[model samples]
Target: MRIGVPKEIKIHESRVGLTPATVRELIANGHQVMVQENAGLPIDLGNDKYREAGAQIVDTPEEIFAQADLIVKVKEPQKSEIPLLREGQVIFTYLHLAPDPIQAKGLLNSGCIAIAYETVTDKSGGLPLLAPMSEVAGRMSIQAGAHALELNQGGRGILLGGVSGVPPAQVVVIGGGVVGTNAARIAMGMEAHVTLLEKSIPRLQQLDSLYGSRLNTIFSTTDALEEYVTTADLIIGSVLIPGGAAPKLVNREMVSRMKRGSVLVDVAIDQGGCFETSKPTTLADPIFTVDEVVHYCVSNMPGAVARTSTFALNNATLPFVLALANKGYRRALTDDQYFRDGLNVYRGHLTHAAVARDLGITHTDALNALI
Candidate 1:
C-alpha cells in the first residue's frame, strides 16, 4: 500500500498527519509512505527526518494525492484538495461534515473512502482519535478565554484568579465530557468560581465524586443555562453530539443578556458550535464580539499548539493508519466495529448515520458500502 501525508493547509493549522516515527513504522511494514515536502516542517519535523525514516518526499500535494492509495491528513480536505481526490482512494482525517455541507458534497462527488478520525470509537465508547486533540483544545479553551478576558483583548478586565479582597471570575463550563472536565479542572486550579453543567446525571454524579466540593456540578436545563450564562464571566461551550452538529445551547438572547465584557470560548465550534453567535475563527484572528460578549471560536484550537498536537494525534492515529494500510479499508473496518464507525463516506456514499441525518443525506451502512 502507498500512503500519503499532506501538509495541512487550513489557516493557522500547523499539525501534520504523520510523524517521522509513524512513517518509519509504515515503511518497515512493507508500505510505501509519501510525504509532502516540509509537511511537518512547521512543527520542526523536517524533510530530512522523514527521508531518514524511509519516506519519499514529494514536492507537491498533487503527487501524493495522485499516487498514494491512502491519504492521511490532520484537517479536512480543503476546496482545492477536494478536486484531487479519486474514486476508491482512502482519505483519513477529521471531517466535521455535519456543519459543512460543501465539504460533504465534495467528498460524495469525489467517490473516495472518507474515514473521519473524530468519529472513530473505542471499546469504551470513547473517541480515541479525537481524544488527544479534544484534550488539547479543552485545556487551551481556558487559556484562550482567560487571555480574552483581559481589558485589551476586549474582555471584562477581570482576572481569572483575583488577588486578596478581590473575588475571582465565575467560569461556567457547559458539558461534562473531556473538554468540559479539563476546562473546569483548570478553572478551579486557577482559583476561579467553576460550575459545570451536564445533561447526563450519571456523568454529573461521576464528576461530583471526582471533584468533591472543588467543582460545582449542575444538571443542565434551560433555566440553569440562562442563569449561569447571564452571570458568568467566562463561559466555555464544550457540548458535543458525536458526528452531529452541536446544539445551540446559548442563544442570541442569552448573549445579549450576558454581562458586558464577558467571554465565550466555544470548544465545540468544530461541530458548528453550541453558541448561536459562534463562527469559526482562525488563530490569527481568534476572537469576535457579539452583543459586547467576546467569543473565542477558533475551530482548530489545538492547532495553536501544533507540535504537541501533531505528536499526540500521531500517537493515537498511527495504529489505525497501519491497520488500513496493511489489511485494506474493507478488512480493517469489517474486522472492527469500532473502526467501522470512522467510515463517514465510502465510495461516494454517506456511511455514518449521525452525519447523514445531520446533513440530510442518504445513509448507507459501512458494511453494505464495503460490499
Candidate 2:
C-alpha cells in the first residue's frame, strides 16, 4: 500500500500526521510512504529525516493525495484539498465532523473512506485516538487559563496559587473524563482550589476516592454549574459527549454570574464547545472577551505545541494507520470492532451514528460494507 502524509494546511496548524519514526516503521512493514516536502517542518522535523526513513519526499500535497492509497493527516481536510480526493481512497485523521457540516458534505461527495480518530473506541469504552490529544489539551487548558488570569491579559489579575495572606484562586472544571481529569490534576498541582463536575456518579465517586481531600467533585446540573461559576476564577470546560455536539452547560445568562475578568477555557471547543457563547479562536488570536469574560476556545489547542503533539498523536494513531494501510480499511475494520467504530464515512456513506445524527445523514452499518 502507498501511504501519504501531507503538510497540514489548516490555518495556524503545525502538527503533522506521521512522524519520521512512524514513517520508518511503515516502510519497515513493507509499505511505501510518501511525505510532502516540509510536511514535518512545523514540528521541527526535516526533509532529510523523512528521506532517511526510506520514504519518498513529494513536492506538493496534490501529488501525495492524488497518488497515495491511504492519506493520513493531523486535521480534517481543508476546502482546497477537497477536490483532490479520489473515490475509494482512505483518509485517516481527526475529522471532527459533528460540528463541521461543510467538510462533511465534501467528504461524502468525494466517495472516500474517512475514519475519524476521535470516534475510535477501546475495549473499555475509552476514546483511544482522541485520548492523547485530549490529555494534551486538558493540561494546556490550565496553562492557558493561568496565562489568561494575568492582569496584563485582561484577566481578573488573580494568581492561581495566591501568595501568603491571600487565598488561592478557584478553578471549576466541567466533566471528569480524560480532559477534565488532566485539567483538575494540573489545577491541583498549581495549589488552586479545584472543583470537578460530572454527570456520572461512578466517575464522581472514583475521582473523589482518587483525589481524597485534594479535590472536590460535584454532580452536574444547571443550578450546580451556575453556582460554581459565580465564584470561579478559572472555568475549564472539558465536557465531551463523544461524536455529538457537546452540551452547552454554561449559558450566556450564566456568563454574567462569573466574576468579572475571569477566564473560560473551553477544551471541548472541537466538539462545538460546552459554553453557549464560546466560538473557535486561533492560537494567533487565542482569546476574546465576551461581556467582560475572557473566552479561550481554540479548537486545536494541542497544535500550539506541535512537536510534542505531533509525536503524541502519531503514537496513538500510527498502529491504526498501519492496520488500515496494510490490510485495507474494509478488511481491517471488519476484523477489529474498535477500528470499525472509527469509521465515520466509507465510500460516501455515514457509518458512524454520531456523525450521521450530527449531519442529519443516514447511518450505514460498517459490517455490511465487508460483504
Question: lDDT tens digits, residues 62-169, model 1?
Answer: 999999999999999999999999999999999999999999999999999999999999999999999999899889999999999999999999999988999999
- Model 1 / residue 249 / CA error / Å: 0.5
Model 2 Cα lDDT, one tens digit per residue, 1-371: 99999999887899998998999989999999999999888667989999999899999999998999999998889999989999989999999898899998899999999988999999999998999999999999999999999998989999998989999999999999999999999999999999998999999999999999999999998888989987899999988877888988899988977889999999989889989999999998999998899999998899999899999998898889888878888788988998889888878888888778978988898889656
- C-alpha positional error of residue 123 in candidate 2 after TM-score superposition, expressed in Å: 0.6
Residue 191's lDDT within candidate 2 is: 96
State each model's CA lDDT, in order.
0.95, 0.91
Query: Which of the numbered candidates is closest to the native, going by highest TM-score?
Result: 1
Residue pairs that clash (backbone atoms under 3 angstroms), model 2: none
For model 1, what is the alpha-carbon lDDT of residue 199?
92
Candidate 1: deviation at residue 227, Å? 0.7
Which candidate number would show the highest lDDT if scored against the true structure? 1
> TM-score of every model?
0.99, 0.98
